[model samples]
Target: MRLSLKVWRQSNKEAAGGFEDYKLDNVSPDMSFLEMFDVLNEQLIEEGKEPVAFDHDCREGICGMCSMYINGRPHGPLRGVTTCQLHMRSFKDGDTIVVEPWRAQAFPVIKDLVVDRDAFDRVISAGGFISVNTGNAQDANSLPVPKEAADDAFAAAACIGCGACVAACKNASAMLFVSAKISQLALLPQGQAERSIRAEKMVAQMDAEGFGACTNTGACSAECPKEISLENIARMNREYIGAKFSSSAV
Candidate 1:
């Protein structure tokens, strides 16, 4: 198949970037999107042109590094899949594709399709974990969580922190991502000790990171590759409100 790619290119953080058009012919439908990019890079190298820069690693789709807004969607037109997992077959021959990096005030453009997602790391660092005592892993039956609770927590944990939610939001809010992180811990007994404090600190950090507030537009969950439920956002809210006037300080 043949396609025209309008890919953004930038030399560095200080460099002004713009879209550069490239034509690719004889593209294999079976090749993953990243594979197609690899071929394009090879062709550019042969012509002494700097290849387009995109973040990708563990092309197996486990890593969230392959972040891009493809053809106006977070990960192309596919649902529940990342860019590296999208195949050329999704598009027809002679198609024109516009590829751009994740857009968000919290995510600074590092290069072409690469954005600095360190804001997510800072959010997690704020209060994503509990202070468990040093010991071997607990036995499965030790906590004995209910089936529904366990399932909900696992579902929330499915979040890969891909920033798809951010890119999909008009406000570029990290609410979905932060909600998933909060809900996963809140549903477990092991997390009870720090639940309120976790919500308070994480929410505070999210604001400090410059991410806009969520407007309940529902775009985040719709574009989420993991399909993280919006219920988690509600759960985080419940936790946050409870923390506001706690009997004692966190």
Candidate 2:
């Protein structure tokens, strides 16, 4: 396949950025999107041009680092798949693909298609973990949890924090991502000790990071590669309200 790519390029965060067009030929439909990029980079290197810089690690889709907006969709036109999993066959020959980074105030462009996602890390650090010791792995397992709760927690835990939710939202909201982290622990017995504080802190940090408010447009869940449910957001709102009430009563 022969294709034209319009890729966003920036030397650094403060630098002006724009699209640079390139023509890629002899492409294989079987090659993964990142693999095609590798080919493009090789071609650029041969011509002594600066290869595009994009974030990618463990191209198996496990890391969620291969973030890109292909055409107009996050992670390309596919549903429930990351850019690393996207293949050339998704597009036809002679296609003009536009690639850009996540557009949000909190996610400043680093270089090329890569954006600084440290805001997410800060939100996680605010309270995304279980600090309460459950004694040991065996002891933690002894706590009985309902089948439904376990399943829900597992689903919420599948969130890879790729920021697709923010990129997809018109307001650049991160409620879905924050809620998924909250629900993952809120549904489990092990996460009970700090449940109230966890919800409050994570949400507070998300707000502090300059992420926009959710308007229930469902764009976040729709664009999420993990397919994280919108129900998690509702649950988080409940958790936050409950935390506020509990704190007020004390």
The prediction achieving the highest TM-score against the true structure is 1
lDDT of 2 by residue, 1-250 (tens): 9999999999999999999999999999999999999999999999999999999998888788989999998999999999999999999999999999999999999999999999999999999999754564565557999999999999999999999999999999999999999999999987988899998899999999999999999988888999999999999999999998886434
Q: For residues 1-250, write the lDDT of model 1, one tens digit per residue.
A: 9999999998888799899999999799999999999999999999999988899888877778899899999989998999999999999999999999999899999989999999999999999998889889889788889999999999999999999999999999999999999999999999989988899999999999999998999999998988999999999888888887772664
Q: Give the TM-score of candidate 1.
A: 0.97
Error of 1 at 164 (Å): 0.5
Which whole-number lDDT from 0 to 100 does residue 155 have in model 2?
Answer: 96
True lDDT of residue 173, candidate 2: 92
Q: Note the Cα lDDT for every prediction shown.
A: 0.92, 0.94
